[model samples]
Target: MMEMFDFRTNNSNGSVKRRLLWVEMESVFGDLPPSGISGSSHNSFTVEKSAITPQECENAVSLTHVGRAGEAQMVDVSPKESTKRIAIASCNVILGKKVFDLVLANQMAKGDVLSVAKIAGISGAKHTSTLIPLCHNITLSHVRVDLHLNPKNYSVDIEGEAASTGKTGVEMEAMTAVTIAGLTVYDMCKAASKDIQITNVRLESKTGGKSGQWSREE
Candidate 1:
């Protein structure tokens, strides 16, 4: 299921105005499709349409455009304070034997495929702002990646972990790490198989922040 925030407040005449903010998942499943493991369908959490304050709406609006003007506007971490943050991301790639063989042998032309890609994934997690159009630049303390080969399905699975101490969670970092790693896998294996596909990238869990802990039941 997913958890989201909706900000709302009363207008000058006391009528309510609502804004759909942050559509994020509470938890995600890494298993392949046909098991209802996909990330698209999930539950959501919402606040009442008249519960928000004017200041909160303004803050949210301003936060959305922090880095756009090429200004180094320091994000106010005071209101959010500190909290332990973590996110898990996973993705799968289906390919032929040659692609798997190259991965297994570490003979891809792009150099040490897994090792280099792992580094890239970690770096990407730290620098998600550069890749994603509008993401906060966060200080991530930990990133770990695990790769698995599933011969039965002729696919590769990537799992990533991201942790930090901040207001916003590291879900974006985890998701970015997994995505970059999956893309790297595709790049290295494309020479061997043109039918390669990356699928099911999503956040598996998160801890800390105001929302508390969340994990997929399935």
Candidate 2:
């Protein structure tokens, strides 16, 4: 049985807003629960409501990336103070048995697979702003790409980390590194298996900037 959950924010009355965190349930016990199961027994799934201050509500209404009249524009960070910003992202490439063995044995037709991918990831991180419009061009201080082979899952996990001292966060740079690294793996291994799949690209963690630190819970 599988389930899906959707979370969204609902703002009403301009003073307070509620964040709806909904979880869809699949019944394991036939169409319905047997015997004494009643509506009152499922109180644990209730969604809670919270109060939002006026300032916070106003801030939420203003979209930073969109200017007046729904015009898209780059965010102005000139007034923001420069601070140490770091971000990490990850993705996985699922490979077939032949490709997996080839990667594990470092016998891919394209020379060293991981080494070239690492260098490409670093280069991609350094040039993220040029690749994606509206992104601030930041001077990165450090960039690292790590690739780990998961024999149990027949996949390779790529992780990218980027750091910079700038007004904007390096989340885009880290994400770009992970994306290019995954693509490089596919490009190198395509001759062995065209069925290779790259997936689960996402930001794992970020630190510094006005938001401080944030990490995805496992």
Candidate 3:
């Protein structure tokens, strides 16, 4: 059977606005009755006008990565102006007590852990597009990776910064750098202790995008 329901709400000036909605319910194996509305009727369905502001509408339309059907696609940045872009990412590598002591004393069998990790990080940033499917192949102007030891936690903190002049931001590159650097640390210290852990890989800050600069809160 078909049912009509009335939905009522107050308008801005306190006047009541009523909308009629049609719903159909089914019974067990019975011949369906026709809806009074014609098969080709255009007024059978009602579409309410959006209440979004002009600025909100503009922002919604500016998201170009996907289509109206919500498919995944790369955003076209060809029309975007090229600008200097910088991003910083950070991660931590926790080591066992024996491995931590060895790292501080530079006695690891795998040689200097921090230096090798730094080089690996820069290489990772340079090849970010090759690693991540959707990332753009940006020519980075500068890449830096630093590692610091925290004796109390037996952890090494890794940070990576990437800079480029391009249509897209370098945030992906920075994140890739930090991730690879952490992996490198794990590889170099695994012989000393198999319990090494890599954690908290994240983008700490990014600058030079349409959205402007962003940083994580403490």
Separately for all candidates shown, the number of backbone clashes (residues 3 or more apart, or on different chains) is 0, 0, 0
Root-mean-square deviation of every model: 15.2, 12.9, 8.8
Give the per-residue lDDT digits (tens) of candidate 2, residues 54-152.
578767857788865456899999999999999999999999788999998999999788898999999999999999998999899999999988988
All candidates in order of TM-score, best leading:
2, 3, 1
Q: Would you estimate the TM-scores of all the predictions? A: 0.64, 0.72, 0.70
lDDT of each residue in 1-218, candidate 1, tens digit only:
23233223334432222222221111122222332445746433454444667687677745434555344464555678688898888898887777777778778877777777787788778888788765677788999987788887778888999999887778989989989988888887787778999999988888899779988754
Q: Name the top lDDT candidate.
A: 2
- What lDDT does the true structure give each of the candidates? 0.73, 0.82, 0.82
Regions more than 4 Å wrong, model 2? 1-61
Rate residue 65 of model 1 by lDDT: 40
| lDDT at 90, model 2 | 96
Q: Residues 120-216, candidate 3: write the lDDT tens digits.
A: 9999999999998778888899999999999879999999999999899999999999999999999999987889999999999998978789999
Best by TM-score: 2
Candidates arranged by lDDT, highest first = 2, 3, 1
